[model samples]
Target chain A: MIEVAGGRLIAELTVRRPSFTLDVSLEVAAGELVAVLGPNGSGKSTLLGALAGLLRPDTGRIELDGRVLTDTTAGVHVPAHRRRVSLLAQQALLFPHLSVAANVAFGPRCAGVGRAAANEQARGWLAEVDALELARRRPGQLSGGQAQRVALARALAGEPELLLLDEPLASLDIDVAPAMRSLLRRVLRGDRGGGDRGGNAVGARTALLVTHHLLDAVVLANRVVVLAEGRVVEDGPAREVLTRPRSPFAARIAGLNLIPGTGCAEGLRTHDGTLVSGLLDAGVSGLLDAGESDSWDGAPAVAVFAPSAVSVFRQRPDGSPRNVFAVRLAALEPHAEVVRLRVSAPPGGPDWLDGLAADISPAAVADLGIGDALGDVLWFAVKATEVLAHPSVH
Target chain B: MVGVGLPVVLWAPAVLGFALVALPVVGLVLRADLVRLPELMTSEEALTALKLSLFTAAVSTLLTALLGGPLAAVLARSRSAAVRLARPVVLLPLVLPPVVGGLALLYTLGRTGPGGRLLELWFGVTVPFTTAAVVLAQTFVSMPFLVVSLEGALRTAGERYERVAATLGAAPATVFRRVTLPLVLPGLGSGLVLAFARSLGEFGATVAFAGSLEGTTRTLPLLVYQQREVDTDGAIALSLVLVVVAVVVVAVARPRVAEGAQ
Candidate 1:
């Protein structure tokens, strides 16, 4: 098995260029796809560059399967070509002069396969991408999606142990994204799942998919690692992380309300004292209990939930969930299928109301006619299980 | 009327300037007697000079490419101190007058010169007054043209493609052979043509270093100069032949450069 086994990708890599410093530590196991999600200048690309051996990490170690790719301590450093890691940048930089077949054959040829053998292998890869018909065509003659597919084939042909994708679909037009995503999912599955021709070694390929698109991560990656200001704010299973984000950044990506708060057995309390009662999820309950002790360092924390999770009624609905709170409709904003209502919870009751934002559907707003009111107390009930506690505000 | 006249007036001088520069070549072709061409081809000295010119130019072009191609690649790829120093030194020969280049070669390879002394001491051989000296002089003058052209091509071709090649598992040498060489071929081809043409017409260096020895050091240009001292018509005929060869070389090499640019 290609086990990563607790190896730390620790880097205090400070490239101070009169603007910013990028410092982060990350770890991943073999057979896992970690999606590095962030906005621009969030050190997502910088971190990938450092990991890929393109940029030298100013300090720290990058290990893969216990093999040191870069370690400043031991003076072990491998160049980019020898790293056996494949990178698919946003550009899909296929060589312009070479034919599609020749471009795919490049890696195999470099690996010491004879020209004819390399070409044969390239044809197989092209057929896998369904682009064997375009093998003789130049990169300039292909569409953006076609070029990206060829690039993916070229990278996979090397049979790299570690694959890094930097927003591989970012440059494509929206109409082609779904098709590209489907193709990418198939490739990812083929590489990871041990049920097909691509499945040989247990964890032969570990992937890090860098993307700003949340849906792409949700669909393709096994786990999502949220990066903000050059540090990982949250990392977990994709569904869990996306639905119940632990950071404001993740909350923004997942379109949920993320507030910094503390918790007790009764519920979570915002720093401004808006008490959210009845957190019954054991995982969340344990976090609440942990926060109630003297040993509890009042470290910065986050409370997150989806907009749909918080039900808004015109008046107090009888037998509603215990975590109900009275809130004034602060602002209304129209999102895709829903109108996100900014509910202002009363201050000093529990600090859970601090910087709290919630999304309510257009149907809920129409049903209640809760429009442009400043001080109307709208009853809002959230299920206890939906209230998630994460350790940082992000 | 004045506005229309102004642009036409402004462009007239440039048009005339181009015509002035092209006049000599047009004059050469126009003045040549088509009937005398067949008789000129039959002359023994003319044929010997043409053959010797072709031979020396081919040898010179081959040597230039062999030596300059690697030198250009090194200058293109390396950031070492020696390479930094050697690049400008390579261009020094290119900028020097052909006669000055000839004098420099003469000083280094003349009978009593340092290289000549070594040759005599080691192998009991001398290169001056020989066809080999003519080839050597022509190569010395023309090699810088190939190096400079190929160097520019290499620089523009960039290291990204080579790095990609390497990552694909190509050893450094294979990347050079497959990717780097083919990309620079157009520039290399044009450089070879220019070097060949320059060698064919090389007179100053050959005369200074190899001396005016008939059938040996007498390249086409040297033969033309020698014939001019006695028979001016023979000189004109040889000049016509050189011009035709140069035109054909330019005709072939220009399209290659244009295609590469595209």
Candidate 2:
């Protein structure tokens, strides 16, 4: 069984360049897929390098399967070749000189297996990736998708216990992503042969997949860890973390409207004089409730909900829900299949209502023609189940 | 008009440069003494010099590749201070004059040199003025070209491919042999050809150390030098042979090396 018990990955590395310092700490469980989400200079690639044993952590410990790979405290550092962890970066860097079969066979040969035996094993892996037909072809001959498959087969051929995938589909075109995702799912699940003994399967291998793409995490990862400013801002089940994010970075990635406020039984009182009501928990609401509740007089909080959950109507409806607001359509922008409508409510009622963001389907938007008028009154409603309130220290 | 003219203007110098290079080769072939070519080919001295040149150049190239391939790989992969320190030292022979490099080799392997003293005390053997000394001197001078070229190729080729091989279960050494070495084959091949060509034309180092023996230490270039003092036609014939051998080597190696480089 693939198990990582208390395998802490703590790194305080300081790489001093002309500008910037990469300092990060991380802990991942076996069978968990943590996505190190960040912008370009967010130390994501550097953190992956440190984890892969390509770069040494100035002060930290990296352990896999309860074995100490790197621990500055006890003075132990394992070289990359001995780490037995597979790292597949953005580019499917297959050896151009060797044939696909030979490239796959490379690991087996290096592990001291006989040439014939390594080839036999490599052939099986090639077949698993559905690349057996191109086994004799060099990497330069394969298409982007085909080359990535060969890279996957080569990585899997070694039967490594820990798998590391760094934006494996980043270089692929949009049409190729779904197919590659499925292929990666199959490989990571250990469904194709070697019988789920090690790797990222449920009972087999453990994996750490790093990617900036949120959709990839939703499709492939079971657990999602959102990294912001080189720190774990939010970490939990992929669905919960992606849908209902706690951090602003997570909120941004999941496309949710997050506002800092105080929670109450009636609603959340935002700092900008807006009251958001219909929350689930009274204690959390009471803690953030601002209206004469002495316990939460000077407390901080955050109210968050999906833009999709906040429905916008052109006119005020008779007998509307409690969280309804009459707002002015400040701006309307098209985003893929949906249109993001930014509305501003009348000032002085509640602090946060000054700015309310809402996302509606293109069909709904077109039918309503919300883009026609800017200053027109737009009614918006949010369900209690859709509203989430948490403490906001900032 | 500017777009079309810009390319032509930029390319004219390059085209002219190639024509200038081809001029000397064409002149050499046109001016060759065809009537005496057959007589020169059958001469015992000419045959001995050709054979010795071929044998010594081949042996030296083989030795250079055998030693330089791993050294290049080490230099390419290592980041240690020792490796960094040794890289310039390994390339020293390439930049040094062939005669000076030969002197350095002599001081280390000559009759009264430290290594030579140990060899005499233990086995009573001296290295100077011998065929083996010629091979050693040629290898010493030619090895750095192979190492430098191969090392540069290895650096540009990167370590990602090797890591991919490792993930596929290939061991470190296996990755080098099967993946790393093969990827850099074009550079290595070109380096080998260059080393062989250098060794074939080697004269300063050979004369300084091996002392120009007729059947042993005398290579084609040395033979040409010796013949120039006595017979100008014989020297021209030897020079023609050297040119022909170089052309053959380039013809055979160019396409394959180009393909590998790609």
Candidate 3:
């Protein structure tokens, strides 16, 4: 039998909720799992709701694989069930009365699959999620993780062309999250744990995952789309966008330092008139596309780099090694395995420089005994080759 | 903690309030002619009233289910302020005196009111003084119980599961039949029982609108009320039976609380 291949999803829709509004236009290739990462109320769920046809967009079109799922002007709109798109909500709302297996079978049964056949298909999905052992139990008897597994199995049993996940792991315990994420990866990759790739019932699924966890994008998605205040602030390859973010939100989530500046004829200059002397053209090229040196004639650019590349010193070093600047200590926050110091920009700095984070080892923090007594200032410098400057989209 | 052991003063009224509900039924049972109960209950008038009561109440319950289901669902899901604001109007019959309810139905469907005239002009049908009028009167007084119960259940159940079911390839009808209906079945069951019990004991509206005929509208409650004029003993016996029926209905519809919200 010939498979009627699923096509890419292209949406240029504006969803206007009473409290929020999301306007985005993008396309996702078939079989690509794109992670939509944003903070709470940033229209991440709104995007998923519109795509799943749960909430109709106030305007614009949503075409999935050339099929017009929503087109306001053309007056074509498909409701949820007919749209062939499935959504896995943040909460695992399994049917309380139905057994785990029956909940899984519900989707197929709705498609007019016979009772026995639907039950058989349900068992297959249950086995895939490793919840076959708990198939006979009702939702009330299952743990949160088990119920989520059944919910996921139920969603896939319908064989949707597009699958939307709204923080599938947000409700799980922190310790149980890793297992669920990995399960999501395996199912999304269509490789059931035995390296049996073709065994997935939902073949080559197109999925959009809304998440706040960077780990979800790092592990499960090949691309990332970040939103802020109901706007698409950034979208690019997962690592590039995360590592070299143009916006502060992405930089914070990716744990990177972004220095805002403008690209001029001579070189890149910080907004506060700090001529960052060390960064080389070669290093900044990696953050931008090929025509960086020529293209960025005069544009708002930001220097992006990992916090580890910054060297902190108690006093002004004897020699200006590469680039040197003094930053006033604002506050201290503990990050994983390291101490992150929030540093205020040298006085009279631009708005973006108000909060700059630098990470140093705990031993260094204690040895320096950095506190209000030490004037709460640290002299930090970065090597020339480590400074990466990219144009800030905002 | 401060109020914990206040006194017998505080506890006496609270305890009495609890006992007050069962004491009256207990008194009726004690005064009933149990020795002659079998003979008294199976008399011609008693049997006619009991059979008519059961048949009319059953039909009324069925009507409540058919009409009240969609009304409850819409009230549960609609966002219109007008629909919400109409709750008191729908519930008026429940709170109104049964005699007032009978009078309202009588005026609206009698011989000259707009509703009555419309039906009369359209189908030459006179609503009052018929067996069908008995069912209609019973429905007017009892349907609000079903609507209120089912509406609470549907509101608590909410649209979450229905939305999930829709995304999972279930059409609108299928979602209602397969997911929505089963989720609210317990509520529906209890509501039906409440409506049935209400209809079985319906007295004021039947007497006022349908009128208490021998084999037409004289339900069990009517029989008990009339037996007091002739045989007070039989009236106590019939009253005791209605009490038993009420108890059975309550026992059958015992709340299955705390089953799934965990």
**Native-to-model Cα distance after best TM-score fit, residue A205 in candidate 2, in Å:** 3.8
lDDT of 1 at B92: 87
lDDT of each residue in A221-318, candidate 2, tens digit only? 87777665655566678887766666666676777877666655555676656677656345564544555465554356666888888887777665
Worst 10 residues of 2 chain B by lDDT: B1-10
Better of 1 and 2 by DockQ: 2
A1-394, model 1: which lDDT tens digit per residue?
3333122233334433344567776776666678999877878878877777767877777777667888877877787777777788787788887999999998887787899998988988887777889999999999999999999889888877677899999999899878888777767644434445442222324788999899988888878988777777787898988876777778877877776666544545666666655444455446547775432235455666777788777778778455677676677888788777776655434434434556767766777777656566677778767876545533
Native contacts recovered, in order, as a fraction for each?
A: 0.42, 0.62, 0.90
lDDT of 1 by residue, B2-74 (tens): 4535556669899889999889878876766667876875599989889998999999999998998999999
Per-residue error (Å), model 3, residue A156: 2.0
- For all the predictions, what are the DockQ values? 0.30, 0.40, 0.73
Best by DockQ: 3
lDDT score, candidate 1, position B60: 91
lDDT computed for candidate 2: 0.76
Expressed as tens digits, the lDDT of each residue in B131-244 for candidate 2 is 989999999888888898788888878887776665555557767777788888888988899889889989888888898989989988998999887987788878888998
Q: Tens digits of per-residue lDDT for model 3 on A143-254?
A: 8888888888998898877889999999999888898898888777564545553434544468898988999998888789998878888898898888778777788888
Shift in Å, residue A351, candidate 1 = 22
Clashing pairs in 3: none
Q: Which digits, one per residue and each the tens of the lDDT, describe model 3 over residues B1-262? A: 3665666687989889979987888888888888999898888888888899999999999999998888888888888999989878888888889988888888999997789999999999999878899999999999998898889888788899999999998889899898889898888888888999999999998888888888987899988888897999999888877887888887887653222222
Structural RMSD, model 2: 6.0
